[model samples]
Target: MRLNGKLAIVTAAASGMGRAGVARFVREGAKVAAIDISAEALEGVVAEFGADTVTGIRADLLNPDDATGSIDQAVEWLGGADILWAHAGMPGPASVENLDLDAYRKAIDLNITSAALGAGRVAQHMRKRGGGSIIFTSSVSGLVGSMMSPIYSAAKWGVVGLTKSLALALAGDGIRVNVVCPGLADTPMKTGFTGRSGDPAEAAANEAKLIANVPMGRLVQAGEIADAALWLASDEASFVTGVALPVDGGFTAR
Candidate 1:
């Protein structure tokens, strides 16, 4: 168990990469405090994981108070928080010129600001305790330009900056901060983006076409991303910090 005896909170825990990471954390012997905005979906994930291993907290991460609240709740539930996975994020149904301003704000609220709030609390606790690991779910879209997604790209880039800045600021305190940049993974969220095109079959085919461009010629599995998070949270990465490790297969390679 890579995370034996550790405590972690995974935001956006209802589904996709977040859900997978939460489950893997539990399977690796970590006590997890999982958060999601959807009550029903959150319950489903909790049910799937069984009751004895994890505690599910449903909350809107867009609210910084809620982000801070989640940390406190996790500490109360699990005795003490040692790892934080800021995995909550959203792309869009809109292009740059046409995207709703409010939607973009919401993305920033959920993606960037909430991460800062959550990490701040986690760092404080870790600082006092002498050590901990913090992981952020950034994207390849942030590292390379995505002409179709400006706000998401901007927000993800902010995550990279945050990871580096926090890493330096907290190095003296023994807290390590890092970000994971996942390539295209086939998750409910990714599926939904394609399915939204109004033609289900066509949308799926379209998604396939996009995946074919990757050198690996396959979608990155949820578990694969989870494994990266597991490594980041483990002592094996003791000397690692402020790095954006790409779990994208070969998407960024080309």
Candidate 2:
């Protein structure tokens, strides 16, 4: 019960790392307000966790109003929030060659701006309660460089920068801000993106190529990422802040 009696908000909670975080937190005795853009998927989460343990909120984080409003709603529903996991993001265009500016803007909004807006609103609530934890999801591309998606790399890099700045700004109020930079994970995002080629052989080859780059030779599990987040959000990391921890199977170590 590491988070016994705590309350939390997890965005992108309908699936992947966000859903895993919600489950882990709840198991540790925290009630969660799960926010996602998918109404049907949100309903599924509520069904899986039960209303007593999770409240589902449907809102598109890419919209500034939805981003901030969802945070307010979550805080209000949970009475207060002790943790926030801003995990909503998308893999943008595959390359910069003839890049669509509109796609670039959308990537920035979803990958970084939403986290900023959500964190800003949640920090206000956290201040009233004395302290809290804010976690953002970045990608290994943020720490290094990604040839596949320069726009995504830029946006995730922004998330790391935001986390560090917010940590310093909110440290005095006992708020801890950190980010998790995950490598290629065994999630829909990864498989779906690789499968975009629509050729099984090509998709498999692409996946194999990505895996070969990881020292561990495997995709990082969503549960593993959740465990990292659990520690950061728990009292165990009370003195920790402003760190960009990588759960990338040694991808960044190289």
Candidate 3:
């Protein structure tokens, strides 16, 4: 309810944290334009949320045009956007030793390039409107070196840098920027983190170990991440910017 009367644009809006954020935003009374790369998933969200409160746009953020276009349409459709969740990113499995040049570039395109473009462009609009909030989805990988997924971790770390600089630069303009670092959340992205395990028992054991490290003794739920996202995008987090808020169940505490 904190976002009542605001309009939000959420990228990666078809699934996981992004999907949860879109739903939370709408439920909190914010109209949202949900963008995702999957046409099928996007259509499904539109069907569930209806066209008025939440609409869907399927586009690859790697395409510069589409990245900017998502912002434009959201601004247009919702009558002016006050919140932007720059959440589109890819987690391609590539080892440093065997990583293909193409895959590495694709990671850069999706994670770093697209996020930078959206941050700059969306900030311009939000600034002109007097004020707004933008939250970038970073990760626990961004905080520490994860050899298991070098490309993804590196890209997420870059997101922290992007969010930090953007927040500092836009502070004067009344536009707030921040980053959310989620730790070991149960999302599709989780499976790819260490490669999918075929054995059910081993996978459960692995999951348990991950939770053991967290002080909270549980993996973060997507809604928990969404709620953090919601507060950052809401007036409740006023005076907050340029910080990476971790909803990691204390994974980073140790």
Residues 13-105 of candidate 1: C-alpha lDDT, one tens digit per residue: 888888889888988889888888898897887788877678889788888789898888877887777899999888753477666889879
Expressed as tens digits, the lDDT of each residue in 70-162 for candidate 3 is 888778787787999988777765487876888888888898888888877888788778989989988888998776678989999999998
User: TM-scores of the models, in the given order?
Assistant: 0.93, 0.97, 0.93
| Per-residue lDDT over 112-225 for candidate 2, one digit per residue giving the tens place of the 0 to 100 score | 999999999999999999999999999898899887667889899999999999999999999999999999889888854576567888778988988899999999999999
The model with the greater TM-score, 2 or 3, is: 2
What lDDT is reached at residue 212 by model 3? 82
Worst 10 residues of 3 by lDDT: 191-200
lDDT of 1: 0.85
Candidate 2: global Cα-lDDT?
Answer: 0.92
Task: Extract clashing residue pairs from model 2.
Answer: none
Model 3 C-alpha RMSD vs. true structure (Å) is 1.8
Per-candidate alpha-carbon RMSD to the true structure = 1.7, 1.1, 1.8
**For this target, which candidate reaches the highest lDDT against the unseen true structure?**
2
Q: Which model scores highest in TM-score?
A: 2
